[model samples]
Target: MTDTTALSQTETVQSKADVVQVTALTGSIGAAISGVRLTNINDDQFVAIRTAFHEYCMLVFRDQFLSVEEHVAFTARWGEFGFNKMSPQLDDYPMVLPLSNRGKSKAVTENWHYDSTFMTEPPAITTLSARDIPVGGDTMWSNQYLAYETLSPGLKAMLAGVRAEFTGTRLAKLYGLDQVPRCLHPVVRTHPETGRKALYIGKPGDTVPRFEGMTPTESEPLLRFLYEHSAQPDHIYRHQWRNGDLVMWDNRCTMHYAVHDYGNEMRELHRVTISGDRPV
Candidate 1:
């Protein structure tokens, strides 16, 4: 039986050559990775995966089917575990949070925004392992680097010294919390590892109520425009999730929106976020 199991594992690795194969999903943001399993990735494969992640900002690994322990282990390769006080975790695995449609009154993630931006030190990376998936429940991600790069020189100059106030208003409301978590981050944040700048704006009155030192009314119009501009079709990649898929994104450089079209269909995924430095 042990020999047979060993043979099976060898055959599985041999079939895929144990090499990482990355294919760009779009011209802008995401990549689809194949050939290496998340359960047992080698040093070379990890280097290649990390390189692709830096270039693409998001990655999709199909047929991962990772267990809670496997998910946490894979996420730790990126960094320390980032806390999400708003989401409940599994009793056995504190770092793994189950994202389900069960008893959810509304989908707070339907808007394009970074994960846990209200935190002083927000998550740098977030990975979701699909447990159950329903048709029509695709998630979309926008390229924030392109969002900043495409702006006019004058607008860029004006925003160079600006900071925005990010609040956990939607998440707070969803979780029925009285106090909202909030923080101030640069409007255009520089990536610590890549040294690239990304627009860090969120939807007005949703996650970002206003720019620092500015009233909500004064910040609304420009904030709305920037939010809309960042989410243009040319700058986005939409992922149609499949069961057993593990998708990870750089929360520092991308904004994601979860589509709730699969209503009452019981879609669920396990999430693990990696902590990052405070946005500069």
Candidate 2:
């Protein structure tokens, strides 16, 4: 992990004294934020948090045992709520979805994917608060910005302005739905906040059906390469979940895979998503 202080240009000298401590989890992406509480974040602290969020693409807060109300409130600070229709929501708190090993045939997130990319405007951010963690339910996130930036000039030019069809195939299968939800988004999309380009492709048969104006056969090789290249070990940060841990990732700039190694030990998390604009 790389240790660095996060400071915004607009930060005052006094604000600097209270700035949150950010340590990079990996050379490529993610940071661990300390010295602040999400329950009662002041304006200055929020500014620093936002800075670390945009720069790191994912933030990890340890030892935050947030209630459903607190989870919703902190997530709303990011943006409007983006609900997941396929997942079961909490009875009283409809916006919070419970992710558990109670009644699932298989783990839907074992493969890497951006959250709800099938939507016309997929979620910009997703936050998960660990409720009941087992021994090994770690999740890994890959940096999509680095994915796009590392591509060759020719491949980059080829992908520029290209769009792909994203589908909710895995979730559809998991829930035994009749029809899958699908949408078209740019293969490489520019982030609205940071103005950096990120590879928007996914595991072809799983989340992505094919590139627009191309047949499945024509798209397979390139899609496979991009998906594999985007998730190289160097560009990823594997987070081992601890009890009372709350993690948030920018879905627009990252893809995450959930490891299901804990078996039936009962791992549960409360998840909240923030809505985002349509991909341009």
Candidate 3:
């Protein structure tokens, strides 16, 4: 009989070659990658894609069309997939979190915040796929590192010794948590992989307190100023999806928001989060 194993190996390599293609977007914001069906990527191809993702910070894969299992498996190829401890849409697949807002079901993720920052161990990466889309459902992402880099040297100097406190209690109030997360992160943190500093201050539930030597009243206006200036369009990219598209983004240096114009037509997306190391 023919060596089926060799044939399978050959087929996999051929499939990967036929399926993978990468395209970068404008303003150093995002990339549009095509080919290499996620469910069937090989080890070598996966490494290449992972490298591209790190360089791009955000990658958009068109024509994924993965089932929940395949979607979770594809995300697992990059890193450990974390369970969703917040949304009620989680099912038997603990690692798969569904993001949908249909009819009376309100959509979450309306603000610009890093996912699961309340935890002592926050996620490193997050993968999302569109299942359903309304006529105008779109997602936007902003680069925090770029935001910090563009700041005036005077402000950057002022912020050098400043830090902000993030509390789970404040976040808990927004999400209706019985208990708050037990971790705190620096307002400015350095990325372990890239060794770049970024503003790590935006979350839906942040309670701004004085930075030790500074008072709360003295800190709030500056914090708000940084928050507003950091989210400017020069640092933002918006993704308008097509069916079967998958996106994976670095949570360490990016923040995202889901647009609300989809209305009642229904939008379904699945997310898988990768474990993250502490910021330096």
> How would you encode candidate 1's per-residue C-alpha lDDT over 1-280 as one tens digit per residue?
2111100111111223466778888878888888888999987788888988888899999998998889889999998898776788999888888988853358888889998888999989999999999888899999898899888889999999899999998888878999998999999999999999999988889789999999999999999999999899988999999999999999989999998887689898999999899999
Residue-wise C-alpha lDDT for candidate 2, range 1-280, written one tens digit per residue: 3322333333222365586778788888898888778898888888888888898899999999998899899999998999888888999988899999843358888889998888999999999999989898899999998898888889999888899999988889889999999999999999999999999988977788789999888999999999999899989999999988999999989999998888788889999999999988
Better of 1 and 3 by TM-score: 1
lDDT by residue (tens digit), candidate 3, 1-280: 4211110111112234454456666465676766677888777778767666666679888888999889888888767877766656565788877777744334446667777776766799999889987787788988888777777778778777565665555446657888766455777778888887787876422543445456667777777877776678867889998778899899998888877886677788888899988765
TM-score, cand. 2 vs. native: 0.93
Give the lDDT of residue 17 in candidate 1.
44
On TM-score, the candidate that comes out on top is 2
What are the per-model C-alpha RMSD values against the true structure?
8.7, 3.7, 9.1
TM-score to true structure, per model = 0.92, 0.93, 0.84
Better of 2 and 3 by lDDT: 2
Q: List the residue pairs that clash in candidate 3.
A: 19-35, 19-36, 20-36, 64-244
Q: Cα deviation of 237 in candidate 2 (Å)?
A: 0.5
lDDT of each: 0.87, 0.88, 0.72
Q: What is the lDDT of candidate 3?
A: 0.72
